[model samples]
Target: MTWVKLFLGSLAVSLSLVATAASMPDGCNCFCVIAGRNTTVDGSVMLAHNEDDSGEMMLNMYAVPRLNGNNAYLWGEFPGTSVCDHFLNEWGVAIASDGCPSREDREDVTDGGVLYEVRLTVAQRAHSAREAVKIIGHLVETRGYQASGRTYVIADPHEGWICSVVKGRHWVAKRIADDEVMALPNNYIIDEVNLADTLNCYGARDVETYARERGWYDPERDGRFSFKKAYCDPYYYTYEHNVIRQLCAQQYLTGRNDLVPDPDTLPFAVRPNRKIGLADLMQIMQCHGENSEHKFVYKRERPWNHPVGICTDVTVLSAIFQLRADRPREVGCVMWVCAGRPCTEHYIPWYLGISRTPDCWRRYASAAQAVKDHFTAVEHKRDQWPHHIYWKGVDRWASYATDWHNGIAAVQQARDKRQAKACKAFAKMDKKLQKYYDPRTLQVKDREAMVKSINAFTEKLYR
Candidate 1:
């Protein structure tokens, strides 16, 4: 383990101090669900994510068709933004994250700290979830993390890892057990750091010593070294709205109303009473927290200022990754992506082997252009949104939210009908397609033919 031993100005990270990230609200949060293979009905590792953000944001989905040399992947892109992107590569590895603010305020960054480049490197370079975590550790330790903090939920076919990062050179990652499920909000949920458990953990070597040196921790007073307790901001960690969203998922799986909204009280991960399915996980991600034991009074006009609940008024997009090892990665990995809010838009299946995404998904500028435009470009205005799929769902969601309870029924009815059709179409496509690829080498026997079929099927779903 190569641990970079550079410590900048030492200042005690105050529990009272608040953290701010690049162009995001303090209350903003994203929800991610990691279901280990043994906990799911089909025994496939499931990772579900809802990208909660507001503004005239745009989402673009495109496949990087360079699998021969570099890795090919389906990039879930948010143009002109640093932290709000997701990816699924050719190896069945998928990555998404929540902006979990930490207590580290020291400016230890080199090259403006690593932000957008972190996830992109994982997508382009990593061969497995473990490799992805190692890549993140190297980048953060050497370059430093740019955001307040973030917990990246990365998973491959066989397992899932929740990699929690601080604002500086300290970080930790833990693997989810096969029988457990983890639901993460904006707060840091990884409390126990067992770096000795090398098989299930990977992190900085001086994670505890650095905190102690900075006066952030004292083993005499704090007992064992809790990375989360020493580094996470108390205000953000216990923020009512975000933790409630985490509890909502817990409630559904445990069927227990007594589960508290606090992270300390709630189990780090819950064992579901029964095996979970795609639909069950979908319902969990779509929750508005209406049925939970605790209720929230809408502080702003927008629900969670339009970004709370597992679902939200400001959710630009959502993804449910069904990652399996039973077959070749091309046929094994699939992302059920919804353009906008889960409540308003239907989730369309996007297979990993597809040659290309629909034109509507690629109407934005190229990948290199988007990265350059991340900080320089102006936000797109509302009226301009109707031209693309992401904004169309945003516009539709905003309209339905006017009537809310009354307006949601008809829209959901039509969306469900379309959703059922998509599921049926995907089933037929998978059955016809799975046999053509070799599972041993993760290669397709007939790449061009399979690509053609995938593109045609994806086009039908888009239309």
Candidate 2:
């Protein structure tokens, strides 16, 4: 009887762990525009991302040190994980990823590092877009890419690259053309990789051979080895939401009415008719599929249309990285981060050179410590006081907006007015700081002042 009870308890614990792992949230979207394709309104290359996950997860900012004595990198990390979904390093390298689950993922569960681990490794070690591609390829081939597939958008001031990692360590990456712009939802976009174009393409040595062994490709019948057709789970291709989002992205970028959503024929990248800017990117990220007649309708009965929008229920944070090569490193890179839903929340600029995060943005170790700190700074008692002040406030505001439902239009109008005013003020302050302070002469006090000013502005938005 004692042995039977012990065995039952162990079995229950094992099942609980499996259930928890299976429920992990997954979804994200990222877009990149090269320098030539940008409007130069801010004189920088831009990359934007929408990080969707379990709505309850707390998204916090982190500055992690590189073990190899390189420059420390700043990233927006979720609680309990060292892997960063969005990150920018001192060398102007910035990267973001989207989840791409495939059929092969179910069969291949080797020792390759998980998604977060692979992302963290790339963020810590790579300095250039090309270097980042090589590093990810090497890591996947050697250690194995353990998670479902993923698509990474890595960029610097000079260029951008899209790398796709699949199950069993097979991967491929292609550099975005100088004048091209590309966007990725939760699916593999890279098709036939050109092995001969070493400068622009990188892939595993056994990519084709492995696909052949798996009976996924036929060299004699299929003219060339198509990565997407071979590795992307056929079931995902049937998902209407994936196709809807991909179509929406292309329509937004190209502004072409004739374009249709066909996975087989959609170009990986294209040159927009008009140069895109940071503001344009923001609008795209905030898209709710409004213009499409086939998708979301303003007051339609289809609740499914909600998930197809760029802004979704589970979006915890969104950001756009502006990397300027002409400006000094300290002031050149800026991350425009929105704590909650992009549609309701405005972006706050955080400079890459900042030494410390504002108290509100920093996460504490425990609830007790958070309370103690709150008491120490009692002046902020009227505002948020707990350890997760920033997150809690954002969550509350997001809830209010969401609950408004059909009445959200009024809320958005008010928020947009305030956001516009705030944007103007931030632009003025950023310009003044850029002109007044030289990176070489900037002191700790200057940085502190900047942080305080930004924090105050952010607090005003919540109020």
Candidate 3:
């Protein structure tokens, strides 16, 4: 009786394993990196679902997580298992070719293809791309396959951003059913995608253009342009292409810079060609933090109408500066309000051309530490009570004169802390988390403690 019980228990465990395996999306293509090879990948296609978009139709790939900084690569290109919908957003199976697409020009692959659908599987999500690649070999050996022109599979070259199977390119229309998959020619032909699109997609063109213009492409300069330049200025790029606008404004107003066309001289700073003058440009650059777009509407009581294609950070700055230049009385009102204060009221300039960033501003770790230190200092000032207790619902109370001084001190302390401990903590967490913890389950023992720790780390920011 004891032996039978043990056997049954063993059988139950085996059945559970089988069920779990079966429940995972089965019969999908997988890829992985070979040992000691940085660029090459090996994998197999499980053509178990002979028909397109029928009978457990699923596709998956194993690749490296992209390295973003320095040498940017796509996230899917990195070492990881990625579950991609074969029917990309219900548009048909897309096969990205060997290169990344440009942000502005790359056409959507989904818009033209015959639609095929596939489901996602846990194995695809749970396992690393490398492990998936290893298992795919055996899965393919067990399940015989069929030819579907729609199934476009290719390896990625180191330079290639993607191994795309675009809908209108390289593949023919095919029907995928539960029992059998059919392949038929659809007269679709492949075309060479433009490199500019690839550069723009991964965020390179503007920097490339800027670097060449600024003579920043010198090999002696460590063979690299500024990382910040190469990466889209998120402040500007996040909204409209404000860098282009800023450049245009500076060039047209200054008239001597040889970047874009110059604007016609006009009575107002805004030119007929929509270029703004030097004064307005400087004001915008100073006040709006270089990349700011004046998309935010001021209160209704403010006398400002949206400018035509000129409603940007520069426009507002131009308007204010022009007012100050032409009408001194208006300028006096602003200066009166802004003068006398130690820091907040003063017009300090922040520019992108600075050679060094304050240690506090460099990374999140330092920034956080700075914040934590400030909170400590501020708490001490507030009679050892949390600021939240006093300034809880007070909107912009920190800007008040008395409160402002305290806030500034607290911020400086935070910034100092960020430069010291924050950086160390961030580096330690990065190393430890990558080594010891599964990133998915990041919950801590106490939520408030975690929040406090995080707040203390980041509170030292200047902006």
Candidate 4:
């Protein structure tokens, strides 16, 4: 089924679907905050993501080994998939993506490449944001992008890049200005491509030629070739949900009340009025367009007219990558991940240096085990299955929050308190660990102990 249909159908059954569907939801949302060295509270670059998927799936983490002396990285992985949806390497490079459906003329049905493989290759090999962009362009040019178009957000400690892929072998990537912040809501955000600006723009050699041949662009009539206008699916471009989500994100980031919700004129990236911080990015990720016309209501009677919020029933995980170039590689990358709905769940910090993932965040040992745990068998009576502890905890909160009438505010407040406490505890622990030991030299046992402690603390917070 098409993503649009899947998204709408999921919304219709959102309240009724149980925690058994392991598939990712149709559409996703994400953003990146590129804080020039001075545009942040602590002068640190930050990238935040809301990985909206079929809320039923199990979320897992893996520590990918370094390849030929390349940096090792930690990424969120699923049971049956090879793609790393969200990842951070030892070099402080982070990558996240949202699927962007393309117009029929721009679809690349011949490309034998998968979207996840592109993301994984870039995450594993690229050392910087710009390099990641070039890698994506090269992959598409040679292997072809097989899936629907997608927008990838790649960032390092200094800057961010948005690489949007069209079907087949054409793509374009643009760098987010050092002082700008960008929010992507499952649609192409690059308006125009500047081939001459090698420092900031990268694209296939036939990007414009292909569009012109297809009658999607005209040099004489159209001032310049727009990647989004030429490639984006018309339905997605005019869809109210996409437009509202983009506008809401832009308004929140710029703090502008007068801006209108028009996709054609929306800036690809904007400079924030003040330095952006981790907390600000977190709040934006959780935004539901509340108290505004674009607010997303979860009532069965109300049709799905707006974009899903940061805490939708379909969101499996949300993460923020805190990368600091000032710190050593061992202590520089921190991924704050919330395994369930962002509204009721607290983000727990996982250091990039950690060698092991707690059992609660690990995937099932085998496919049989996965089926038994999530589908066929019911070992835990109260939760209906013997899923991982993390999932059990998520289900507990979701039961209440999904009610929407009485449980939202209370869950939101409690989650906020828990997250704040966890953040503070993480800061203290990270400081202590970095002060005495280099993460690179830490023994496996030491890493395991740290992970256990953090996992234990997370369980306590939920309890």
Candidate 5:
């Protein structure tokens, strides 16, 4: 016997890599970044995200008040995870996304498609970011993209867009140019296209003849058809975990020593080497690829056998937003959250002219019972998460990612002494609520003292 058939083919390739790493899916390891408004330092068209989902999820927030006629916005809920919800509206626009997994395994959809109404129909009907990339290419070319592709990014207060959806009715979009800087992962970082450049691209008009009738493109051995190299999903888009988190967010936004991790020599947007902010998008969304030789093994019950960072260990939440247009688009559209893993918490900020977001950060009292309990992937309960702030950031990020090098310098010295006292109480609460509003009809000139001074400085930075 040929050595008992090589020990039963090495025990059936170690039980099919432990049944494909225990059937991986706590929502595709998300990450995103955008900059644009002249590449940041507060001219603000910035965007940032990292909502890496994992089990027992529940983190909601709603201010959603323009019911059925849509757009009153400020929802972030993640109930039943249809593309891990996020938004911001009242015409400052804003949205977030990252799970890009396309190479369309053709569901060619009609109805069970359009996962969670494509960023809530571009935050209830776009107000800009070029009408949210034409409402995500007309809801993925008329109700098509159900899943296995998504990108979104969309912004306002002077533009920023990304929109890379594909899983059926093809898509593409791009526009981060007011002096560039984009970083994204979870795949599809939109590559070369021009639906004849209608002011910097938009999607599908047979998107390269349907990727050359599904041979996934071959413009003579693929010379120019680059929708992320012919519609990504090349085994998780050539993973080294989305190429070392988009080369650790363009080497922390361009201090770049010749960036690598070669997804065809990366650069779907760059220009930084200076002016980016919100503490460099919260230190590159609390990066862990810190000078990569690779070794931050945050497995958290086998989150795809480790090695995926731009902060992981199921980065429950982390945002940045900050979409300013030099003043009152209702208090310059802030977001800056963290309810966990911005390297173990502390971000807080909120404000898009708040009117309520501190009933211990809510949990479904109606947005139609949280979109009828969305896709129902329930877990979050344990006595309603010890009265909430997203379960104290999922209990201090499951004890600081279970020993992230001896508790990351005491969670970055108590999250940098509460991010320098909540950014000096948000610059004295934006100079005392921009004199109770009227920086040209952002209206509020004393709407109950600007919603009681933004609900008492967002409940005094969530206590």
Candidate 6:
């Protein structure tokens, strides 16, 4: 059966067929159902719509992940309350006053056989009931029921916030940098190649081309698009966030047995023709890096533990892989990928463009919490180095870098006439390092010598 017919049929069984058609918003996402679809092997059909005055973008039939659940919906607006510090599991657009509810068995309002509802809210009266139905109806038709996933839209001078669609689904609501706030940045320009495609990776020149067209990178700058600039854009980063978040949530929801109906019952459909798995998702999450390959090398040239770099392509592949085979153990490993080091702090501020790093985010919590868990896994094993060797080497190296950075900061602070006692202490330390160690270059000339000194301690201890 055709997916469009199947979806309409499903709705017919739950609601008045005429009502279903009449109730649908003019332009909202649709969730198509088809036979032999909704598995990694067979695949499912998707109908998504982007409703903006600028354009109405819609995808009629695209293969969607199996774990997306049995019911689908088309939704564009979300209504809820904001609960700061509330822990939401799935990444979607929604507002709640408290974090994700601890209970997963909450009731859902039904429409067209699908389950949904307004779980929490602040200004419920301000948001019209008709709009709520339209939003829910639109969502159900498109994405199906994402357990904790939601998308929100707001009105007026305060624009909506775009959350990070990566590991945590946190907000991406900040203005980039001061310079780029009103200008187009490197990633915004529509070019010969569609930037929204999950699989597209253009070379620096193509990136430069896009930036130049957008006025983000002018060759006149020394950084050559490397330096950060500001530009106000609603579409570029918005699409990036939404696409990645939906894909990642799908990967997790469909792949893990933890989410299955029963321990014995298989939850998702799979496609036999493809290779999809956790490793693939890991690669996808790191797709933003400059590496030609999607692979994230931790021990190589630029070993960034890029938790945020993972993208939609990676998430889609993972969802497909997990649907094909139900692996609870593998899910645990995927959890490790999020919460473990060097996954947490490695990508913060640098890759995320986040100005503030929350203390909770920096510290590791639980493997189940995914990328936020950092304490459990140590990237560098202490046993790998001799006991005293690591201590002496690391401590000395830290002291050196601290002294250098402090020296620079001190000079700048002094020039600004904002010197404090702490700055003076660091300044004094910097002078000592300069006198003892050459200030010509900041790096230690012979790290090997330091290692040799530590090795002597190890030899003596063992001998």
Candidate 2 — number of clashing residue pairs? 1
Q: Can you give the TM-score per candidate against the true fold?
A: 0.90, 0.80, 0.19, 0.81, 0.33, 0.20
- lDDT per residue as tens, model 1, 271-349: 9999998888878888888669776554556542333477877677889999988877777899999888887778888
Better of 1 and 2 by lDDT: 1
Best by lDDT: 1
- Judged by TM-score, which candidate is best? 1
Backbone clashes, candidate 6: 54
Badly placed stretches (over 4 Å) of model 6 are 1-273, 290-308, 311-337, 340-463
Per-prediction count of colliding residue pairs? 0, 1, 42, 3, 0, 54
Q: What range of 10 consecutive residues in model 5 has the weakest lDDT sum?
A: 14-23
Candidate 6 residue-wise lDDT, 1-463, digit = tens: 1322334434433332111111112111111101121321212111111111111111111111112232111111111111111111111111211011111132232333332222211112113212332333333434233232222221111111111110011111111111110111112221222224322211222334544765655767624343112121223223333223223323332332232211112211222223333323333332333232222222222222222333311111111111111211111001111111111111100100111222222221222232212112322333422342223423432343334334534433442342133234323433433332233433344444433432332233223
Model 4 C-alpha lDDT per residue in residues 272-370, reported as the tens digit of each score: 888878888777777777624665433343222223564455666788887776655545667888776666677887777765556555554442343
* TM-score, ranked from best to worst: 1, 4, 2, 5, 6, 3
Mind giving the per-residue lDDT tens digits that candidate 3 earns over 1-463?
2212222323222222211111112121111100111211111111101111111111111111112111111111100111222111011111211111112212322212121111121122212222222222222222211111112221111111111222122211111111211111111111122335423112212434544554534546635443222222122222222223333333333443344321112111112223232223223322222232323223223222212222221110110111111111111001000111112222212111112223322211232232123212321222332332112312222234334434655644543454345335434533432322233453233434433433333233232
User: Model 3: how far is 187 from its true place, Å?
Assistant: 42
Q: Which stretches in model 2 have alpha-carbon errors above 4 Å?
A: 1-40, 65-68, 81-84, 105-114, 296-308, 365-387, 401-405, 436-463
For candidate 2, the lDDT comes to 0.63
Off by over 4 Å in 1: 1-26, 67-69, 303-308, 364-378, 381-386, 438-443
Tens digits of per-residue lDDT, candidate 5, 1-463, equal 2222222333322222211111235334778888888888778897888888656676788767676666788888876555777798888888888877776776876544455566776787678878878877876676577567777888887988888888778888888898988888878878888878889888888898878988889889978878888888787687777877788788778877777787877888888888877988898888878765543343245623223478777778888888898777767888878876787677878888786777777765666566555544355464754676677767666665555677578768988998989999998999988887777766667777787778788887776
lDDT per residue as tens, model 2, 26-99 = 23333233333254465577778887664245555655544345456776755433222577887778887776
- Pitting candidate 1 against candidate 5, the one with the higher lDDT is 1
Candidate 3 Cα deviation (angstroms), residue 415: 3.9
- Using lDDT as the measure, name the better of candidate 3 and candidate 6: 6
Worst 10 residues of 3 by lDDT: 330-339
